[model samples]
Target: MSKVFDFSGVDDFCSGGFMHTNPKDSNLFFPLGRHVDVYFPRKRSHVSAPFVFSGEVKPQPSIEVLPDECLFEVFRRLSGGQERSVCASVSKRWLMLLSSIHRDEIFPAKGNLDPEEHDNTSISVKEDEAFKPKEKVEFVDSERVKSVNEEFEGIDSDGFLSRCLEGKKATDVRLASIAVGTGSRGGLGKLSIRGSSSTRGLTNLGLRAIGRGCPSLRYLSLWNLSSIGDEGLLEIASGARLLEKLDLCHCPAITDIGLIAMAMNCPNLMSVTIESCTNIGNESLKALGRYCPNLKCITVKNCALIGDQGIVSLFSSAGHVLSKAKFQALDISDVSLAVIGHYGSAMTDLELLDLQNVNDRGFWVMGKGQGLQKLKVLSITACGGVSDSGLEALGGGCPNLKLFGLRKNLLVSDTGIVKLARAAVSLESLQLEECHRITQCGVFHILANCGGKFKALALANCLGIRDINFLFPLTSICHSIRSLIIHNCPGFGDVGLAVLGRMCPKLTQVELSGLQGITDTGLLPLIRSLEAGLNKLNLSGSVNLTDNSVVAITKMHGETLELMNLDGCKYLTDITLSEIAQNCSVLTELDVSKCGITDSGIATLSGAEQLNLQIFSLAGCSFVSDMSLPYLGVLGKTLVGLNIRHCNGISSSSIDLLLEQLWRCDVLY
Candidate 1:
């Protein structure tokens, strides 16, 4: 009789005494007393329909369900991963709905789900015509699919199926292979398999499917992913246990057992970029100082088997949490400069130190005093072993130095730029590109004492800079020069462009590329006193600039321009780019490379609609073609980095409509 397990008609029902068909009937009563429904069912239920009590049949209104915080707001809109498997296949009341949520907010613990849930399960199994795939496998494995459509001729159609399934997934392909299967390819938290290096047979199955699907991957970029190796980087240091930024730049089949399996499995690795790997030496810097103890930043560039015992085991193990180090600028020319002069005085918050091709015993071990006053950007380019006593020991030890790049440091002359401009008085940006034994007395001692806190002054190819008289002591002593790059200075002309238009009146960026003795009377009075503090203007290869100096500098400062580089100037034409698109309405980056304009100078830059342009370089302009790409797609919807490299009369269908009107471009060289 106990078989009548009635949950009191179940609405939040509660009852304990069940499963007892009278186990030996030990007076637990329901045996005969109270007439336990007389030991059974008179048709299972008392179908008592005769009572006809019109208002008392109210037993169906028991729906007080929505509890678990309203089932977690319907599991936070069915928490991703294909809407939680389409809300767990919508049934069994949403499979007990969000069965206790929190599994990293319903998935995405690296791969398995979220890649927009494997592209919404490959567009719902390609619109499931009875779960598709009994065919579609032509990505490699051919001899059919019409010889894979003739090896996809000149390819297209997503690059011949992404070069024959580079996303590999076909083993008996189940239901369109569940979004690149193997649990939808591992956790790619920050995995950027850059330039896949011609994928040599799926590079160890994409590094063992990202170490068995991103086990909570933590930033891993195999930059040149050259057929990865060392057993797929020891299966990514034993499956990325929360790795932390590791970029194997030119991954030449990694060595040192993948840096001893990422120093015995990524111990909270911070940043490690083996630039030109070169089989990492010094036992991978003593196994990254015995397992990345919070390594800060280490970039071993052109690693010729890193010397100085791998920079003294990387500054004796992460030189106090190294704030950033890029060695192999010729391995500090075989370490000296007192072995980084006492580790650069204990690297007190080192802020970028690239001893490029270091010499002079690593610049007298980085000029003795080590603590480079909290160095702020110092690059000794082509460090012919620095001279003038390592630029007077880095201008008396980096006094809050502000960017000092000594390019091609051929024994930096002018008494090492007047003792690094009298000990860098907080020099604000100084790059003596191609130093060529600097002259004009170290350019008038940094335009007379750091030109009032100069802001960028690159004397490119400094041929003992001929006069405009150091631009009148750099515009009356650096009136805070906002970027003034003098490329191939040819001793500047127009009397140094009218003494840089009377001492840079707050010059807003200017580069006189190859100044062939500036003309137009020094760019028409320096564009009428830099027409209201210009805004980026570089007359590339200014072959004595013509077209009346670009129509008198776009007629008095083309509406306060915004980035304009007339590359190779070539006697400017097209009426000086249609008077700079009718008075440059705030131009936005325009480089007329090798200009000889055509297509009517891109139809006067399609009437530069208020020039809201965004990076447009007509590389080596060959009289524009492809009919000037539909007028450069009306400035390709606010472009972004579009350099029509070698514009040999544009074709390839004008780069497919300039990549469909620069669809949010990111560098289309």
Candidate 2:
């Protein structure tokens, strides 16, 4: 048993003897002193104590009886430094706690502390005295927090409420506001308050809080935040002087004012993403150029307000430092291209430039500059203004260009293609999709020049391509070509595909979608030749491929195969699918949508461990019923993406089991 003391009404509990509490039990407490008196729980009268020790007996004192130094240590651990200072008014114990907690706050130096003030310190000094002295301590400024917090209304109450509950007991301590103001003295390095959408108009408050608390912040991401504006941004700029990466994507409210403030304040700014900020125009871009001389990468997609002048300003300001620029889906017409060509000549270090939707005149202007020698990937899709002449200029200037996208450029013909093939000797991937005038003659030129290094070739909907003979020379030279896509080429038949398989022995992926003339006869030779590296084969809309082609492919490349797409092949039945499920050991993704697969095919796939399947797409396949759901559950553990959309036969029970079995499944309709 332990003695109990009551001092709840006692205002100050600073000086006292050593307190004691049972080592095993924290609840029983008593004080250690000759004048100590105990009060019974039922009565108010104090009783005298002899304080005699007995067997299996101990004394535990209340918090009021503990020594001031021990009490200060307890309070220091609880309140830290900032809260301890504010709570000091409650009692002497709190004052001691505040002093003890912040004793080592200042940086240590020799001959800094006053000798007269040294005796006033309650903390015992070490005898060795080798420790360096420090100067007087200073409190964190409140004015900086106030200036930044004013822009964010209604956010201060929650912050104050949280602080009030922390230190001492003061019911009347009605905090007016809590601001994390300016100065980079003791600030946070990185401030993140993501996924807090319910706190309306509080994002600015959050930003201000960070600026006040973390002055040395380097990286900040305000993604999907709509409440932040110019005032909050300016506060951050003035406070976080060492900021580097700033991501403000989806922040529609940010305009020229906020962007300019950021550019001017953050000198070490390296990467910035301003996607979907429609209000950002020329003036702000110029500010970015003038302030952030070390800017490297910038993404400003869908910024409709940005025109030729803004782009020119941006390039003129940061062209020398920019290494990557993405301006996708913008209305950058001929004027913008001219501006880029003139001012962008300074961007000699540029590697990737996505100028999608900039017309033919823009391409000509871009080609006129000699700075694009280091350019690698260039995409200029849907630029109706571009003609064959623009491509000729690009080929002549950008000799090191590798991946070139000329999709939807209607004027590109055999002559322009031949010119590009001869000049761009380093070309590895070329996209000529919807270039209706491009013929085999142009492709032959590419084969003769840069075909040996080509990796990916896309010629989708090229109407002039009649035979695969032009590809043979290229495939023969570049045996390393991996991905070959020739969709909607009506002139290509079995002969072309056979030649492709024989020449491109290292091809890993082949997309022959919408080739109506291609039958199993064309696929058989290719499948046999691609027994080594072929992993993905897209034969969608090739209606003529029946059980024979699938059987031959499964028997040949079953072990190494991963994904096989046979969508719209109506003739494929359960017999071929069962054979595939039994033989293909490495098959993970099998897309047989709109095929004539029945319950038998599902049953065949149910027990095969060699399938090791993850993504199973059976959209538009009406033959499968609820019977296949059981088998799906057995194989559901490894499934990641399952698309059974438009499968009318599946019921709610089957879906429930699917949801239970495949914990990581993403079911798409």
Judged by lDDT, which candidate is best? Answer: 2
Residue-wise lDDT of candidate 2 within 1-669, one digit each (tens)? 252443423324322322334323322543335444433243333447554532354555456667777765565343222233234334433332333332233233245443322332222224112221122122322212111212122212212111211111111111112222111112234443333233353546445544544455776766555666777687778767788887776666778998899999898998887777767777877888789988887777777777667777888777777766767656666776665555554343332234455667667777887657666777766666778888888877777778888777678888887777667777789888878888755665565556467788888887877765444344344465788888888877887777767766778888889998889888888888873667888889988889999898788777778989999998999977787888898888989999999887888887787778888888988988898887777667678889888888888777777777776888865
Tens digit per residue, CA lDDT, model 1, 1-669: 243433333233333343445544623433333333222222335545432211222234322255657755655454344344333333323323333233333333343534554442233334323322244333223322211111111312221121123222221121111212222222235545555566443455445544643455666766665667788777767766678777777778788777778777888888887877777777887788667878777767777776677677667666656666656443644353455445543343332234555555556556555555666766655556668877777667767767777776667687777677677787788778777778644665566566367677778887767763443433345567677788886876786667656656567778888888787877777677753557778888887677887777666667787888888887776777788888888888888888778887777778777778788887878888888877777777787777888888888877876786767775454
The lowest-lDDT stretch of 10 consecutive residues in candidate 2 is 165-174
Runs in model 2 with CA error above 4 Å? 1-206, 216-227, 248-253, 276-278, 302-305, 328-362, 439-445, 460-477, 487-499, 514-517, 529-532, 606-609, 637-646, 654-669
Task: Show how many residue pairs clash in every candidate, following the order shown.
Answer: 13, 15
RMSD of 2: 12.6
RMSD after CA superposition, every candidate:
19.4, 12.6
lDDT of 1 at 472: 42
Q: What lDDT does the true structure give each of the candidates?
A: 0.61, 0.64
TM-score of 2: 0.66
